[model samples]
Target: MVEVDNATLIAFTVLALLAFVVALIFTGLSVAKKSKLFVNTIGEVSAKYETDITPATYAFGIWNLIFIWQAAWLLYAFGSIWRYADGGPVLMKPDILPIEFYLFWISCCLLYIGWLFLWDREYLFYAFIDLFLLTGCGYAAVAYQSIALNNNMIGLMSKSPVDVTLVYVLVQNGTDLFFSWTTVATLLNLASALANDPLLKRNLSAKSASTISLVILGIMVLSWSLIENTVWFDYFKYVYAWYAVLLWALIAVIVKNYDRTNYNSVFSIVLLCLVVIALVVKVAVYASRIS
Candidate 1:
C-alpha cells in the first residue's frame, strides 16, 4: 500500500479547490451572462442548445447544493489531516481514508475543470467524455464512503454512538448525495450535448437522438432506484434526504416542462416509484426498530 504523502495530500487539496473555484466562476458567468468565451474565443451559441428533455431552469439549482457539499467534503478531509496536531481526540486520521478517495477526488475535480474548458470551446463531444468520467469518479467516491462507514460501524475500539452517527451523517450521506446527483448530472449533460452539437450528429437521425436521450433518462432513473433508494436506505438510516431532494428535482423538471409525448412523463413516474420505495423502506425499518 502506497502511503499518502503530505505533499501529495496538499496537491490534491489545492487542485480540488482550484477546480471548484474555476468551475464556479466559469459556470456562473456562462449561465448568468450567457457567455461562451473560451480559449481565445472559440465558442458556440448557447441558445440553440435548449431541448425538450432539458430540465427546467429551477432544476439547475442542484449545482448550489453540489457545490456546498463538495466544499463541506473538502473541509472535513482537511480537518481529518489536522484535527489532532494540537493534542486532542482525532475525529479522523488521514490514514483511515481509502485509496479510492484520493483517486476519486482528483478525477472529480478534473471532470469539472476539464469539462468547463471543453464546453467553453464548444467541444460537447469531449465534454460528454468528462461527464462519464465524472460519473465514474462519483461511483468510486461512493465505494470509498461505504468502506469508511463500515469501518466506523465495526470499530476496533469502542466509539460513542453520537460520534459514529456524526461521522456517518457527514461522510456517508455527503458522498451518497453527491454521487447520486452526479449520476443525474451525467445524463443531463449527455442530453445537452446531443441537442447542442450538430457536428456530433453525423448521420444520426432525429429519432436516433431522441431515443438515445430517453435511454439515458431510463438509465438514470433505474440507477437512482437501485443506488439511492434501495441500497443506501437499506444500510444507512435517513437516506430519505437524498431521495427527497432528488425526487423534488425530478418533479420540478416534469412540472416545468410537461410534455405528454416526451419521455419526461415516463421518467417522472419512474422517479415517483423510487420515492415511494424509499419511503416504504424507511417506515418499515423504523417500525421494526420500535417493535
Candidate 2:
C-alpha cells in the first residue's frame, strides 16, 4: 500500500466532499428541470395526437421518488468516504462484507432485506436474488417514465414557460432510459459471471456483447471507486485511460450513424462519454495535486 501524510489525506477528503456536494446540487437541479420538461413533453405528445391530458398525472412523479432514493445513497457513500479520509473509521469493509452486502445493507436496505424474507419462505426461490433486484430496478425505471408522461399532461395545460422544462425533460428522460439499459447490461454481466446452466442459452450465446458491456461497466465502477476509495485511485487511473479510448470509439460510431429515431442509442453513448470525461477530469485534478 502507498503511504500518504495526514495533511494530504485531509485535503483529499475535503476535495471528495466538495465534489460530492457539487454532484448532489447538479442532480437536484437536473431533477427539477426534468420534471418540467416531462410535463411539457406530455403536452406536445397529447397535442400532436389530439388527446386531452393532465400533467399532474404524469408517470414521472414516481421517478422523482426514485431519484431521491438514489440521491440519498450517493450522499451516504460520499459522506462515508469523506469521513474515512478525515481520520474516521471506514464505514464499510469489502473483504469482510461482500459487494452485495454493502449494496443491500447500505445502499438498498429495503430490497436487500426483503429478499431475505422471500429466501427464508422459499429457500430455492431463485439461484440469484440479485437478478430480482435488478429486475425491480428496471421496473421502477419504466414506471417512472410512465408517471412522467402522466404528470406532464398537467404541466402542458398550464401554458407556462416550458423552455427549461423541455431541456430537463429531454435530458432526464433520455438519461433515465440510458440508466435503465445500463442496468440491463449489468444484470447480463452478472449472470454471465455467476450462472452455470446451459438452458440459459441467450446469456451464453452473446459472449461478445456481454464481454464488451462488462468491460464498460467495470471501467465505470472502477473510475467511481477511485474517488470513493482513494487507496486505489492510481490503479484505477490506468484503467480509465484505456477505457477512455474505447468509449470514444463507441461514441464515434453513434455520431457517424446519427438518427433522430435512434435517440435512445445516442443518449446512451453520450452519457457514457460524459461519465468517461468526468473520470478523466477527476484523475487530472488528483494528478495535479500530487505533483
Candidate 3:
C-alpha cells in the first residue's frame, strides 16, 4: 500500500475546508445579488433569455436540496479530517478525500463562483462556458468518488450500518446528485445562451433551438445511462438519486411547457419519457446481475 504522510493529508483537508467556505460565500452572494441586494436576481436575468425548454420557476427549488445534501457531505468529510488530525486511526488507506477529489471539488467550486458572476453580469455565452467547466469538474469529482466507493474505501471507514449509510447518502449519493443537477443546469445554460444570441435569434427560431438542444440533452442522458449500466454499474449499483433528480428536472420542463403550442414542449415530454424508460432498463439490468 502506498503510504500518505500526515502533513499532506492535513493540508488537503484545510484546502477543502477553505474552498468550501469560498463556495458558500459566493453562493450567498449570488443569492443576495438575485434578491436585488445589489443587482437583479439570476431568475430575472434568466427570464430575459427564456427558451422553450427552460424549466419552470419551481424547478429551481431543487437547489435547496442540492446545497443541503452537499453541505452534509462536506461536513462529514470535515469530521473525517478532524478525526485524522486528532490522532484517530486512519480509517482507510489513502484518505476519503483523495488528491483527485480535492482537485476536482476545488476546481468545481471556484469555477461555479466564476460562472455565477458571468451569469449575473449577463455574459450568457461566457457563463455557459464556465458552467460547462463546472459541470466537468463535478463529474470528475463524482467519478473519483465512485472509484473509491467501489474499492470499499468508504466502507472501510464505517463502524456501523448507520455509518455506512451516511457515507452512501452524504458522500456517494451527494456527489452524484450535485453532478446530475449541474448536468441539467449546463443544458439550461446552453439553451439560454443560444436563445439570447442576436445572431442566432435572427437565424433560428427559439423553438427550433430549444428542440435541438432538448434532443441533444436527451441523447447525452441516454448515452450516460448506457455507460452507467455497462461500465459503472458495479460502482453505482442501486444508486438512483441522480436519475431521480434528472427525472424531476425533466418533469419540471414538461410541467412548465405542457400546454405551450410548440413542438419543443412535446419534445420535452418525450425526453422525459425516454429518460424514464432508460432508468427502468438500468434498474432491471442491475437487478438481474444481483439475482
Model 1 misplaced stretches (Cα beyond 4 Å): 1-47, 85-96, 156-161, 201-211, 223-242, 261-263, 282-291
TM-score of each model, paired residue for residue: 0.74, 0.25, 0.88
The models' CA-based lDDT, in order, is 0.60, 0.38, 0.75
Question: Model 3: per-residue lDDT, tens digit, 1-291?
Answer: 234675665676678778878887777877774444326567888788887878899988888888788888877776765454224424334454566776888898889888877888888878888988988988888777667656754445453335556767788888788878888888788787776754343535667768767888888878888888988888777567877887898888888777657777777778888888888998899889999
User: lDDT per residue, candidate 2, 1-291, as tens digits?
Assistant: 123444443444344345435544543443353653122332232223210111122333443544454455344434444444214323222111122222222222234333333322222224235435644554443333333333443443233234224323332333343344334323333433333333344433333433444455556545654553375343222333223333543454344434566543444465566667766676676777578
The Cα error of candidate 3 at residue 250, in Å, is 1.3
**Best prediction by lDDT:** 3
User: How well is each residue in 104-162 modelled by candidate 1, as lDDT tens digits?
Assistant: 86677667767767776766667778878887887777667565656545441353345
TM-score of 2: 0.25
Worst 10 residues of 3 by lDDT: 85-94
Quick one: ranking by TM-score, best first?
A: 3, 1, 2
Displacement of residue 232 (Cα, Å) in model 3 is: 1.6
Where model 2 places Cα greater than 4 Å from the true spot, the runs are 1-128, 144-159, 163-171, 174-178, 194-291
Clash totals in order: 0, 21, 1
